[model samples]
Target: MNAELEARRVERESSRVISAHARSWQLVSALRVEDFDVAHLGRADQVILDMEDAIDDRLKQQARDHVLEWFAGGGKAWVRVNDVTTPFWSDDLSALAGSPGVLGVMLAKTESAEQVSVTHHRLGGHVPVIPLVESALGIEEATSIARAPGAHRLAFGSGDYRKDTGTANEAVAMAYPRTRLVLASRIGGLTGPIDGPTVGSVHSLLREQSEDAVVLGMTGKLCLDHEQPAVINEEFSPSPADVAWAVDFLEKFEAGGRVIRDGSDKPRLARAELITRRASYFHVDPR
Candidate 1:
């Protein structure tokens, strides 16, 4: 690569590091190789090549080939593989193992810890395995899946989850599952869990749903549209006001010799510290 091209590649590689706490996880279908432009990742902190439900069964092999070819050409992304129950899961693993640019794998419809462990082991136990919990049974078993030996993080598949439970997509209806994932992530020592995607093109609706995820303690969200990442990143990030408050609070706490004056002090200190850390990591400046 030329100097300019090498510099751009380095920048995108840095973005992938931030993706460890990525707010917007954008999904590009493996069937659409034309969309994998690193220059046009928009505000997505991470990109995922989906090889599961998004691709037709008849074209599964074709999609897999496209993903591998992209890897060969120096493209980097996480792969959302087929569920362990499917025959295609093995094929997905076979193609992904030792593949350059395979950042990690997201296991679809994950229902058990064993599935996560197996997938991680299949990839030689080095690649991270993020489990997408979509079914009612999966929700019930979420903590185990989160604590599983090879499990990296958890993501909610809200659309399929609602279908499994016959529930509405409203926040009130989905609150329980969202909270379950959040608590499970904490218990499992993983970063905050990723929430499901909002299913509309309306920016207002997308913002509303992303804010709802924040309120429910989800730190990241799956995004379907390229336009959705900017909005999702904004909502998931600590706002300037939040950073300002945290900075001021920490200064005052330090001035007071870090003494706790009331029951609220400890929680406030924790919150402030968390906000400051996230602001620093996300490159948010206090306004």
Candidate 2:
């Protein structure tokens, strides 16, 4: 009976993934306007509006208005405010949180859970706080940060983190921090501990960076351009080919009570690991 139930569950999940994959492709195909164009105002899955240096009230109001408009039109918007301890932080939070379209604040350079909790309390618990782990200290304290009140997600700031740690090459320098955020988010049951943005123009390089992020268990990425969205989405979304391959791999591996490989025959049985990848397409492609 248990085996029969398990088989049914697998069948249901596979069907769902296939349907979601089709929907994801449809969305990508339907993207008609450039990301910077007004017509494409809210097409992005997630947009980070930064207000780090906006000291003028008028400029801050304009920034808030722009973000609110983006959110109201259908995009998820997060404000990357100035440092929490800075003078600009309070006004930025008040303006953004009061705006109808803003969903949350991306607390830049978060050092502790206490900072997030306090900010949440100030926001009246109406908005989510996504902590940006941008320092060696932040990475070291990631688990607590994930558990902070109103912290729905954690995002790594690769550039800032590298600067803070005085390291180069994310592949080698940020490996431990990336892994730490992923594991911490998993243990804390958060939606994502997002990988940071790629800092290059080469499409292949960005794709490789995204692939490395996936290997490190990040749920999504921070993209600087719309073109990067497709690569990130494709990496996170399970293709029809992937679904078919997984089904075959699982059947063979379980039948033989051993690991099975693809047509290339290279021992690739990791059925459980495919669950999130397969489900990712059901929601917006977070890039």
Q: Which candidate is the best by lDDT?
A: 1
lDDT of 2 by residue, 1-287 (tens): 25654465344434332211221111111122233222123224455566653336446556555555655554434567767877767877776666665657778899899989988888888788878889999998899999988887888888888888888865877688889998888777786567887756688887787777777877677766556656766676555556666666667666885554345444354443464355445452222
Per-model TM-score on C-alpha atoms: 0.95, 0.72
| C-alpha RMSD by candidate, in order | 1.8, 10.6
Tens-digit lDDT string for candidate 1 (230-254): 8988899899999999999999888
* Clash count in backbone of candidate 2: 0
Off by over 4 Å in 2: 1-43, 53-62, 68-76, 249-273, 280-287
Q: How accurate is candidate 1 locally (lDDT)?
A: 0.88
lDDT of 1 at 8: 71
Where's the lowest-lDDT run of ten residues in candidate 2? Answer: 23-32
